[model samples]
Target: MSDDPKQVLRYPQVQAEELADWRFFLMRLHARFRTGSFVRGLELVTRIAEAAEAADHHPDVVLTYPHVDVDLHSHDVQGVTSRDVALARRISEIAAELGVEAAPREVSTLELALDVPDAAEVQPFWRAVLAYEDHGEWPEVTDPGGRNNTLWFQEAPGATGEAQQRFHLDIVVPREVAEERVDAAVAAGGTLVTDEHAPAFWILADAHGNKVCVCTADGREASGE
Candidate 1:
């Protein structure tokens, strides 16, 4: 293990070719593997559990009939770190041993965002209604079981009028995948609202002007914006 397992690694620091199977999105590492059958997926999951137990670091795993999804992050540091990178490598190796191929491009996470004049005032209501738990220092709520999409409150102050869309989605995907999605959306009649936050996020609007953001972890730590 590294001397500083808790040291958070920036997106650039962890983007080596060995991690091609994984994607950095929203401060975590995500990967998906096609297992072809539920039995094979369960076998991979069992190996992952053994590896995680040995390393004393665990990842979130989900098994389905044809795929196994894994999400890795150092929860204590609230970000990806050397620990996650090492564990991700181990899991990838385990998947390879099981003849499971990775589908990196298919790994993505969705989050809901609510624009409000007073995030502090509105956050409690949503948290309670959704039965979600508070996470990090942000006014965000997440499913306690990690099944549903996370909900984050964006304080837009005076921007919450009837003219503005109060809710939108933040789709976190790989940097290259995000660009591809943006292109596809534009081809399908969606408009690019702004790339002012490119790589970190791109604001896009539908034909009716409803908005969503395609996001990645690139340059987020450097810009700190």
Candidate 2:
């Protein structure tokens, strides 16, 4: 609610200890424009604004002639959310549309590791499902994006006896795409764990018996509530 547009723009930054939800995004600006011309900066802001509009999410933007800094958060939820990620993707796409090549160093990836009793079985299922590849140990799964950052999965030692996971991923897809993907997952040896009574999300377990959910984007929107 800050009057200054720049102040309203939330650039991706390290989250304070109390603000853990905001840490999911990695923010970056074009280096050449960082101290460059005003007109160019305004152009960047316009492009960023367009992207935000497209995603139905607005980011906090700071403009200084040739340089612009952007921060993305879901104000509706009062924190960073998947809406922020969708907006960030659009922003990066807009930058590319404007002929501004993102510097290699400007990219970042967030790594997440999951503990499963059978790392070997769970890793391959995820790698194939997400189109990720092997990176570290045989049981590890990794997805490398532009920033050389990766989402990793490794075996949790002594985890064979646990019957339930403390955390899991909710794989969201468009409503039309959900059944196909769910069927494919089932064909790949995943089992139906539970049906969400809401019909918006279905929990499925992989071969190793680890659970994940196949959900609709709208369902995710509701769950986040």
Candidate 3:
């Protein structure tokens, strides 16, 4: 939640329908122009405003003492549309020409830490099931994505809760590749938890007893789009 009215105006989700017809997207560009001068801040604002005006797309610019936050969304569409993306890309190019360093986009990864009574048993089961190589020390399992997507199992000493498996993994693969991967996992001793009916994501479990899913990319696309 942001108190900024401009931010609210720029990100209304109801406008997503308007976005579908649009050909661009929104982007936020930020930078600390010069280390010491307040005048440099003013100059940066002026430059951004001029660029926006020339492009006929104005961005909501927020200037703090040392940082600037630019929110770019298409007003005509009432949300982020393809036009907004075009403007954002141009704004970034302009900022770069003016020596402003754009902020990096953020990405997310899932982290699951479960309490397995036997860490050794669970670790081996997962390694063999996913065809993951031993990374050694601390004992971790990963997909081909390597360290980027990893699963670490730690021993939970004296823990006696039933293995309800409240949390599980959603493994995704291309639709064409699904059967092959699923077959491989089954052959490697992993169990098929459910072939019941997941619209997109498939659910599975490893030999030592942790649940995971094999899904199609379309599964994620459906949820997002």
Candidate 2 C-alpha error for residue 159, in Å: 1.1
Summed backbone clashes in each candidate are: 0, 9, 6
Model 1: lowest-lDDT 10 consecutive positions: 122-131
The better-scoring model by TM-score among 1 and 2 is: 1
Ranking by TM-score: 1, 2, 3
State which candidate, 1 or 2, has the greater lDDT: 1
For candidate 3, write residues 57-144 as lDDT tens digits.
7876656566555655555544554445555566566656767654434222354576776766667656654556555465667555
lDDT against the true structure, each candidate: 0.81, 0.56, 0.56
Q: What TM-scores do the predictions have?
A: 0.70, 0.45, 0.43
Can you give the lDDT of residue 148 in candidate 1? Answer: 87
TM-score attained by model 3: 0.43
lDDT of 1 by residue, 1-225 (tens): 345899988877877535989999889999999999999999999999999999999999999998999999998888898899999999999988888999999999998877667666655544543446788788898988888889887777665544677566666667777787787667656678899988799887654455668788896888773
RMSD of 2: 14.5
Candidate 3, position 24, lDDT? 25
Worst 10 residues of 3 by lDDT: 21-30
lDDT of 1: 0.81
Query: Model 2 over residues 98-151: C-alpha lDDT tens digits?
Result: 665444344234566676666666665665444456754445554443322344
| C-alpha lDDT of residue 33 in model 3 | 30
